[model samples]
Target: MYDIQTIFQTANPILNQMPYPMMILNPEGIVLAWNRQAEKTFGYCAEDVLGKFIPFIEEERTYFYKDLWQKIIHSADPLHLESITISTKKGEIVNTPITLKAFTIDNDRYIFCQFNLGSEEQQDLLSFNEFTSIRDGLESSFMMLSIDQEGLISYANNLFLKYSKWTPKRIIGKTFWQMFPQTPESSVVADAIWKSLQNGRQWKGEAEKITKDGQSYWVDLTAIPIFTSAKKPSNFILLENDITDKKRLQNRLEKIAYIDQETGLMNRYRLEQIVNTMISENHHFTFVYFSIDKFYSLKELYDDQAEQVLIQEFTQRMKMYFQDSSMARVSIDEFVVLTPLGEWFIQGFLTYLEQHPIYINNSTLPLSISGGITKYPDDQISFTHLMKASYAAIQKVQSEGGGSISSLTKADHKALHKKSVIEKRLLVALDKKDLKVLYQPQLDLITGKITTVEALVRWEDEEIGTVSPEVLIPIAEETGLINDIGSFMLEQACLQAAAWHRKGIDLKVSINSSVREFRDKNMVKQVRRILEDTDCPAELIQIEITEKFALEAEAETSIIQQMKQLQNEGIVFALDDFGTGYASFRYMQLLPLSQIKIDQTFISTIQYQPKSQMLIQGMIQFGKSINMSVLAEGVETQEQQDILTEFGCDAIQGYHISRPIEAKEVEKLL
Candidate 1:
C-alpha cells in the first residue's frame, strides 16, 4: 500500500489546484480546510476562511449546514450531492451542486466537500440566451434594463439604447432620474421598483414615458428583484413593452361605438348617455329636439341613397350654423343638438337652417326643421322630464304647422301642468263615471229640422271646473288613456242614440273619433259591438274622423277600409275638419262618405276674407257634385247661417243652432 501521509498530501494539492470550489469541515461543523476553487468561487482564500464556522458562508447556510453536520454525526451517513446558492465577496450569487463525506484522521472527525461552479455559469448563460431571443422576437418596440441597488443602470439592451436616444456606453452607468429628469411627479414606476427591491416582490403596470426627443409614449413595464444568498435584494430586472398603438386602437374603437356611422356625429345612444350624465352631474345645459319638415315625403320621393346624401348635406349646413354645438342624430328624420348656447344662438341657427336648401344629387331639397328647446336646471331637472318638455314643444310646433321652432316657455309649462292635471282627473273621472257626452244638433238648412246630433265629450272635475275637449283629448291621446275614454264615449253615445230611437226619433248620431282611436285595428269590432249592445241601427251611428288621419298612407288606408266595411253594414262615414289638410281632395275621392263638415277655421273667417268664402263655395260645389251632403261648422251668426244656406249647404252645426247639451237636454231639443 502507498504511504498514507504521501497519499493525503498529493491528493490535497490536486484538490487545492482544481478549478472547482471545495471545502472540508470537522465533525463539529468548523471549517478545517478550503481549496483554491472555493477561494475563486467565494472570493475568499484558505487563510481567511480556515477554522471559521462553516455557517458563516451565508445567513441561510447557518441552519442548512448545521442540519447536515448533525445528520452525519448521528447517523454516520454521508450526504448525497445537492444544489445550493451562496454569495461571493463581490456580492454575486453562485448556484452550485455540492457533495459531503465524513472522514477520520488521527482520531479527529472531518467532512470533505466538492463544489461545481460551472453549473451556475451554465444556467446563467442559458437565461441570458433566452432573454436575448425573447427581446429580438418581439415586433413592438421594447427595452430591457438591469439596475443595481444604488439606482445605477448596469446593463441596457439594444432596443433600449435605440429608444432612449443613447448608446449602451452612455446609459450603462447612468441612473433613470438622470436620463429623464423632467418626468412628472405623479410617476410611480421608480417608486414601485424601489418598493419591490426593498420587499423582494415583483411589479408590473403601464407607465407614461418621455423620450429624449421630448415625445411622449406609453409603456407596459414588468420588474423583478434579484436577491443575494441571505435572501436580501441586490438588483432589479426590468422589461418594457411599448403599448402606444394598442392605446390608439382602443380609443378608435370607443369612438366608433359612440359615433353615428353616416354623419360621423354623436348617435342617439351617445346623446342619451350625455343627457343622463349631465343630469347626474347636475350640469346646466340646453337641448333642442328637431324634426325635419316634409322629411317623410322627401324620403318617399328620393330613396334611401338620395336621402343619405341629403342628410349629409343637411348636417354640414347645420354644423356651419351651430359652429361649436354638439349635434347628434336622434332619429331617422330627427337631429338633436345639445349646447350651452342661449336663445339668440338657437334662434339664429334655426333661421339659418330654415333659409338654406340642401343640394343633393342635383336636387334642391328644402331643408326645414321644427324644433323644441328645453333647458336644464331651468325647464326641468330630471332627464325624462326635460326630454318630455322638449318633445312636447316639438309636438306643439308640429300640430300648429311645421317650419317653426319654439322654446319651452312659462305658458308652455303651465299648459303642460294643466294637461297633466287633466290626465290624472280623466283617469279618475273614467273610474267614477264623471265623463259624459253633450250633443250639438245638426239641422237641415232648408227644412230647419234637426237631422243629426254631434256627440262632444265633456268632463267636470271636482277641483277644476270643466276640461275642454281640445285640452283633455290630446292629454288622453298622449297618456294612452284615449282607448278607455273613447270606449266610454262610444258606449254613452250609442245608449243615448238608442234611447232617441225608442222615442221614435230616427236620426243619425255623429260622434268624433280621434286619429289615434280611428286607426286602432279593433275600432270596427268595438263599434259593431256597441251598436249591437245598444240595440241601435248601424245606420244611426255616424263616425267622424279628422282630415289629418288621411295624410298617413298606411294608417289611413287601414282606417278607411275598416270604415267602408262598417258603412256597407249601414253605418255612415263623414270627414271632419274638411279642407284643413294637404290631401283633402284626394281623400274625398278615395273615402266613402255621407257628408263634408267645413272646418271652423274657414267658417270663422268667411265674413272677413273673400278667399275663405270662395274656398268654401268651391268645396260646397265639389260636395254637391260628389252627391255628398255638406255641413258648415261654427255657424254662430245669422249671416254665416244665411251664406251656408245660399251656398246650398245641406246641414249646419254650431252655437247658433244649440250649444252642446247633456243627454237629458237632448230629449227637450228634439
Candidate 2:
C-alpha cells in the first residue's frame, strides 16, 4: 500500500516535463496529483484538487464516465474520451479530449489521465489579445524569437539561445534565413513562411535549422505577424518546440525499411521500388534471381559469426563483379539484381564463380550459385510479372539439380503460373468441402465377392474444373498441403465405412498415403483420433502407399513406428503400384504390408506380351508365398479378368469391376 505523499513524490518530476496536462488518481477516483500543465489548462491549483473526488465529471455524464473508466480498467489499451465538455475553475465551459490508462505501482492500481488542450491538427498562433493573455504560460515551455520586417533577428529569448547555442550579442543582428541554408527542401519551406508572414497570416510547420556548432535540429515552429495601430505588419514572433529526438528516431526507422541488416545491402522493398521506377520510364533491363545451393547445410556447419562473414564476403564479390547492376538481398540465401547487361553477363559470372570460391572459418567451402534470368519488355511488361518469371526460371534450375542458370520461356511461365494458382487454392478447396472422396470396388477373384474398395480423392474447382490426381497430387505434395488433404480423405473414408458397417456391410475402404504425410510424427495419433470421432472400426480402414513411398519409408524409423502402431490398432497397410518403381524386395522383410497391387501398365499389356504375363504370374506367386494378397488394377475386359483370375490373383480392381464413384453411388452398388 502506498501513501499519497509517496505517489506524488515519485510522479512529480516526470509529469511536469510532459508536453500535455496529466493527472494521477487512485482506483477509487480520488485525485492524488496534478502537474503544472493541468493547472494552466483548467485553472485549478494542485492544492485545491489533492485528496478529493475528481472535480470535472458533470452530473449528466456520470454514467458515461463510469462506463469509460470500466473499459480502461479492463482493457490493456487506453480509453480516449474525445471533446468532453467540462467547467473550469473560473466557471467557463471548455471542450477537451482526455485519455485514461490503468497502471500499477507497488501492487496498487492507479489511473493515469492526459488532457489534450487543443485538437491534433496544426493550428496558428493566437491573436494579439489572446497571445498576451497566455504569453507567460507559454514562455517557460517554448523557444521564442522576434524578427523585424527586414528578416533580421530583433529579439531572442534565453530558451532560443540555449537551444541554438548562440549568445545574445552574436545572434541579435543576424538574419533568420542565414541559420537555414538554401537547400532544395529548405528553400521551399522558407518561401512558404515568408509569403504567409507578408500576407499578415500565421504559419505553422516543422523546420530544420542548424546550431552554432554545425549540428542540425528539428523544431515545431509557429510564426505570427504582429500588426501596428495602422493595421500594417511590424514584426513576426515565432514560437518553437524542439522535436530533434523524434526526427532522429524517424530517420533511423526509414533507414531500416530500405537496408538489409545482415549484409548492408538494399532489401526486397527497395529492389521492387527501383524496378517499378525503371518500368515507368520504359527502360530495357534484365532481372536475375540467384540462390546459394545447400545454404541451410552450410549455415548449420558454421557458427553465427562465420555465417555472417561468409555472406558479407559473398556480397562483396557480387558487388565487385556486377558493378553496373542494382542488387538486393531478398532472403537469407536468395538475391536479385536488375541490370542492362545481356546473356554474356550471366555466362561470365558463371566462369568467375568457377575461378573464385568463398573461403571462411579456415575451410574451403564449395560454393555454387543458381540463377534465373528474365528480360523486361521481352519476357514480361510489369515488375510483378518479371519477378514471377525470374522465380519460375530459378525453380527450373533447382529442379534440374542446381548450380546452373535458365531463362524463362512463354510455355514454362504459363505452366508455373497455373501450378502456383492451384497450390494457393487447394487448401481453400479443402476448407469449403469442394474436394470429395470416391470409392472403387475390388472384387475377390476366388469368391466372386466385393469386400473392399479403394478411396481416391477427386477435385472439381470452380475456376479450373476437374483436376486429375496425377496433376493435383504432385502439387499438393510439393506445397506440403498433402498432409491436410490426406487427413481429410482419411476422415471422410472412415465415416463412409462406419455408415456401411451400421447397414450390415463389412466393407474395407483403402486410402492412399504419401511419404510426406507420414513424415509427421503425429500421424498415428491423427489416425486414432479420426477413428474415434467417426466410430469406425480400425479393421475397416486400409492405408495404401506406392512402391516409391514404401522404399522411402523403409529408411525412416518414425514412419516405420507409426505404421506398426496403426497395424497394432487393426488397420491394414497395402503397397499400391508395386511394379512401377524400385521394389527393393527388402521392403517385404521390413514393412508390415498385408497386400500388394500390381501396376496397370503390366496388366494392360499382359494379353499382348508374354513377358508381362509371366512377370504378373511371378508377382502373384511371390505375394502369396509371403502370405500377402495380390491384387491387379486396371483390368478392362473379361479376357483380362480371366487371365488375372487364372494367375491366382487374390483380388482385382479395374474398369472390369467398376470405375471410382461417390459414397452414395457405392452404397447403391452394394
- The number of the candidate with the highest lDDT is 2
lDDT tens digits, residues 1-670, model 2?
1254553644465566555687877766778878888888888898878877777767787677666666666665456677878788988889988777676544566677877662265665666678889877777778898999989999888888899999889999898886665588887887789889989988887899888887788888888898757476888898888877546534433344455656777887678889999999999998999888888888887886666777888898889889978999987789988889877877588788767777777777778778989888877776777777888788888888888888977887677668777876797898887898889999998889888999999998988888999999999987788998999999999999999999999899999999998999789999999999999999999999988888898899899889999999999899999888994988888889999999999999999999999999999999999999999999999999999989999999998889998877877766
The superposed Cα distance between candidate 1 and the true structure at residue 202, in angstroms, equals 35
C-alpha root-mean-square deviation, candidate 2:
15.9
What is the Cα-based lDDT of residue 275 in candidate 2? 90
Residue-pair clashes per candidate: 0, 0
lDDT of 1 by residue, 402-501 (tens): 7777877888877766666677788899998898788898989888898789888888788888888777877888888888887888888789888888
The runs of at least 3 residues in candidate 2 whose Cα sits more than 4 Å from the true structure, single-residue gaps closed, are 1-161, 166-214, 218-263, 267-285, 291-317, 330-334, 341-370, 376-388, 391-405, 585-590
Q: How many steric overlaps does candidate 2 have? A: 0
| Candidate models: Cα lDDT each | 0.74, 0.83
* lDDT for model 1: 0.74
Model 1: residue 382 alpha-carbon error in angstroms: 2.7
